[model samples]
Target: MLKTLSAYIGEYKKVSIKTPIYIIVEVLMEILIPFVTASIIDKGIQAGDMSKVLMYGGLMLVLAFISLFAGIQAGKYSALASTGFACNLREGIYSNIQNFAFSNIDKYSTAGLITRMTTDVTNVQNAYQMILRIAVRAPLMMICSMVMCFIINPTLSFIFLGALILLGFVLFFIIYKVTPIFTEGFAKYDDLNASVQENVTGIRVVKAFVREDHENKKFSKAAGNLYKIFVKAESWLAFNNPIMMFVIYGSIIALSWFAAHFITDGTMTTGNLTSMFCYVMSMMMSLMMLSMIFVMVSMSVASARRIAEVLNEKADITNPENPVMEVPDGRIDFNHVNFTYKKDSDKDALEDIDIHINAGETIGIIGGTGCGKSSFVNLISRLYDVKDGSVCVGGIDVRDYDLETLRNEVSVVLQKNVLFSGTILDNLRWGDENASEEDCIEACRQACADEFIERMPDKYNTWIEQGGSNVSGGQRQRLCIARALLKHPKVLILDDSTSAVDTATDAKIKKAFATKIPGTTKIIVSQRISSIQDADRILVLENGCVSGFDTHENLVENNKVYREIYEVQTQGGGDFDEAGE
Candidate 1:
């Protein structure tokens, strides 16, 4: 985990190094001040020499200023390094997420990834800053103060040693008790974030259903779970302050009592006892800082592991080393394919799917819910790999081609269309970044989207709200269709993309596809028989198996599932799922 996270430190390595160096210098300067005070008390003030006192006092002020300057430099560098490290971490995670295959993405929830990138990263960032500054400074200060105390009088230093042993045990116990709680708390954070995301994204549905009170209750439960975990963890940490104070005060009292007796016996001077007091305070403060560092590190350890999980996750699918550069044509062959969304699943999502599609052919897919209509088309574009057998494009295996080359040649406009926040032209340009205005207008015309675009005051330049919320569902689907058309892909898969549009508009879009892009292989997945009756051939799926693959006329006469669906939709006005049942 450390190795994976450290790789993203990238450009900030210099600043990270400088922070600790400055901290070391600051600690050295602070360590000398008490040594100088001892000289002032013994060699100058007691001997009645004003010059020595002035000299030592002036030197102490110089050390104090140097320490202040070094501390400020350490603070500046640590801040820069930690924030830069955090920026790099977020970028790295997002970039990695972009490369994840569909299967890789299924391993993590949207809310879980967001929490790792946000709250978890912030925790690690803070911990890193503390490590660079306080973590370095505290131990060094404690050790140096201990060395000075031992050098002054070895017998007196044993008091501090006993105190150290007791405090270390208490701190260790606190950290051990709290670490697992913090880990569990971060997991609760994912649940809380998931609740908020679901509520916000589907707030319209919630309000439509009059479920505002239910949503409130759901959010409160998630929030309450997180609150309880943190409260439990903090209750354990509350022992820290009281334990620290007890050790510090007990050590101080023991030192004062022993030193008073020693001074009366003339074995230890007043000057040495005063310096011992200063060193004891310094050592105690350093222990306090160390305890705080332990708590922070314990929390960050969990966050670090979460971050490393993302950074280290290799994509399940990657381009071959010597990959095929180009797709020859739209022809696709699924040779006895078997697939499942999960590796350990007992059943396949698509089972023994053997189908062949010729270039420039229009194929239609019809199925009930969970019948693998989308899953079948997804394999055509290699959005997923087949568990058994091979999916070939243009007579070549899909895995043998460059991922970008294959995906670019096969554009998929999914059932749930999404539009980013941008102008209409900007959104369309995603299909072809360098496409000209004339090109966009042409694609929109073919998708029957130009009608709406022309009706709008700003036309192609109109700003679209995020997720295209400002537009009607039909309008959003048309825009998405237009966007996909701009790709000019060899194969285009529309997975129930026209469901939102009216029957007349849907028919027009299909007609436009038939006329405008005749050479492109179009695979349409729909529940409506009207959408697919005119296709060259239709595929009927039952569960994950193909029930029939033939033209509309042949399927109506021969295939039971297809015949029932056609009969119900044409006469009874029922959906495919009802007919299948």
Candidate 2:
């Protein structure tokens, strides 16, 4: 985990190195001040020499200023390195997520990823800053102060050694006890984040159902779990400060007592006793800082592990070594395909699907809720690879083509319509970045979206809220269709995209597809029979298998599943749901 995380410190290595160099310089200056003070007291004041006093005092002032400057430089470099490391980590995780196949994404939750990118990264950054500055300063300061004290009065210095050994064991015990609690606490952070995310995103539904109290209770439970774990860890950590202060004060008293008798016996001078006190203070404070560093490190270990998980995750889908860059035409072929969202699952999402679609042909797909309508189309763009057999686009296996090239040629407006926060023109431009104002309007017209867009106050220039929350469901669907149409893809797959629009408007969009873009292969997945009855061919799927694939007239007369659906819709017996939902 350390090796993986340290790799992100890319360009910041120079700054990271500089921070510790400055810290070491600061420690050296700090260690010299006490020695200079001891000289001023014994050789100058006690011996009645004003010149020695002035010289040593001036030297102390110079060291003080140099130490202050080094400290400032250390702080500056530490900040730059830590914040830069955090930015690089977030970027790395997001870039990796963008490359994950659908199956890879299923391994992690949305809230879990968000927590790793934000809270976990922040923890790691704080720990890194502490490591760069305090981690270097504390140990060096302690060792240098110890050496100084022993040179002056070795007998009194042993008190500091004894205190350090006792404190070391105490600190080690505290860290070991608290680390596991903090690890469990960080895991609970994901649950807390997930609760917040679900509540905020579906706030309207929560309010509509009058489940505010229920949601409150749910959030409280997650928050309460996190609070309990932290409280338990902190209760154990509370011993650190008190134990450190005990050893610090006890060492000072012991050293003072020993030094007083040594001075009376003429074994230690008054100046030596004073310097011993200074060394004692520096050594104890250094130990205190070391304890704090250990605490920060313990808290960050869990977060560091979480971040490493994302950084180390390999992409499950990658383009072939020698890939086809161009998609020649719209023809699609699924030859005996088998796919399962889970590799070891008993049932496949799509099973033995052998279907062939010709170029520019309008094919209609009708299936129940779980009949794999979306799954079947997803394979065409290689969003998820098939477990068995091959999916071919433009006469080449999808895996053999450049991923970007294949997806660009086969545009799919999924069952859930999505629009980003942007102007209508901006959202449409996602389909074609270089498309002009005229081109956007033309795509909107083809999708039958221009009618309402013109009615809006700002038309194409109107700003859309995130997720298109400002627009009605039908309007959002139409805008998504316009975005896909702008792609001018060879094959256009609409997975229940028109379900939100009225039947009449849905019919008009289909008509526009036939008249405006006849050479594009259109595949429509719908619950309504009328939306697809006019297609060149219709595919009826049931229980993950194709029940029938023929023209509408032949399916109604021969296929049982297709005939029942046609009968139900024609006799106004409500919509046809093959899943029987």
- The digit string of per-residue lDDT tens for model 1 on 1-581 reads 99999999999999999999999999999999989998999999999999999999999999999999999999999999999999999999999999999889999999999999999999999999999999999999999999999998899899999899999999999999999999999999999999999999998999999999999999999999999999999999999999899989999999999899899999988889888999999999999999999999999999999999999999999999999999999998999999999889999998999999999999999988899998898888888889999999899999999999998899999988999999999999999999999999999988889998999999999999999989999999888988998889999999898887889999999999999989899999988999899999999998999999999999999999999999988898866653321
> Pairing residues by index, what is the TM-score of model 1?
0.98
Count of backbone collisions in candidate 2: 0
Candidate 2: minimum summed lDDT over ten consecutive residues — where? 572-581
Candidate 2, residues 445-474, lDDT tens digits: the string is 988899999999999999999999999999
Clash number for each model: 0, 0
Reference-based lDDT, residue 29, model 1? 96
Per-candidate TM-scores read 0.98, 0.98
Worst 10 residues of 1 by lDDT: 572-581
